[model samples]
Target: MRNREETYGLIVETAYKMFAENGFDKTSLAMIAKEVGISKPAIYYYFDSKEKLIDFLFDEICKEIMDQYAFTVEDLTVNNFEQYLLTIGFQMIEEQEKDVHFNKIFNEYILLATRKERYMKQLNKIQKGYFESFSMLMNHGVTIGAINQENVESKSNMLAMVIDNIGNFILTGLELDYKGIWKEAVKSVLLSVRND
Candidate 1:
């Protein structure tokens, strides 16, 4: 018999698979329970409702991004700043390459935001918070004399836009060299930090 943690993990993973294969609206809790070989009431023990399950999945995805940020920026220093940007850019590409399912489901939530005011507000808040967070880092660089003071806001915006959309860009199935293009894109930010 699965322990409580094991049952919860199975439910979440199975629900993500089902949600990715079928549209979120089309995937019901009963459907997930059937796929997991569990009773519908058992699923209710883990997730009270389908929306709550999605909320859990979405939160998990966000948690993944936040967790990555911890390690991504943990070693940030002016000396390694350019390499830092490249590392982050390339990592974004790699993650998107591997997690297309999460990307698709995330986009589905974005589409849902179009019709649902709560989701729209949440998306707006998340995007703005993302922008501000990156901008704050750029400002810190300026304060520390690592990043140039000129056009810091614009630089932050450009980099944040690229970072935020790497998943969407991958989903577009463009065959362009993302790493090379990102190298070109970060050149603008690199100029401010790089001085021989």
Candidate 2:
């Protein structure tokens, strides 16, 4: 079972790299199998089809991001909101820097989601989950006198949008200093909701 899990992870990672380099439409299951040093049947044993693999990859990435968010906001407080935002922003920047191919593949998935109804549905569902989590955090802040009780829903939505856009910008290879820009953007959001 452990080996199966490891092989599954390897196949997903290799397929993402190939997709990043050659694109999803251009990448084939045989190529992924070859890259992972596995037989085509082995690959099929794990994933029924390329589309299933893509969906699995998307879900896995979403789970990881959500897990990170949960950890980041575990001890949420108004005083620490800025620090937390900065921490997450920098962490995302570092992640993108660590593997340009992953960023490219993620960006490509975003683009593909826009053109495909099924992919777009999945993306939207994930985004809605993010918005809900952010909204809950802001509502908690309001209850604790950390944030002003003014349009918490809208404020959360705005914050989520800003964060998502910053990520998209970074993934698309923006030339500016994204870390600095993200800090400023997060600061702005925090200031906008401060109880003071």
> Best TM-score goes to which candidate?
1
Q: How accurate is candidate 1 locally (lDDT)?
A: 0.78
- Model 2 lDDT tens row, 78-146: 677667667876887787777778667777788988888877887687777888877887777677566
In order, what lDDT does every prediction score?
Answer: 0.78, 0.77
lDDT of 1 by residue, 1-196 (tens): 8888988888898888778768798999999999888999988988899999988887787667665554344556777767777887798788888876777788888888898887787667667777777787777667666788889999989987886676677877777688887888778776756763
What stretches of model 1 exceed 4 Å from their correct place?
Answer: 68-75, 192-196
Output the lDDT of residue 150, model 2: 73
lDDT of 1 at 164: 69
- List the candidates' TM-scores in order: 0.85, 0.78
Displacement of the residue 86 alpha carbon in candidate 1, Å: 1.6
lDDT of 1 at 101: 79
Which 10 successive residues of model 2 have the least lDDT summed?
65-74
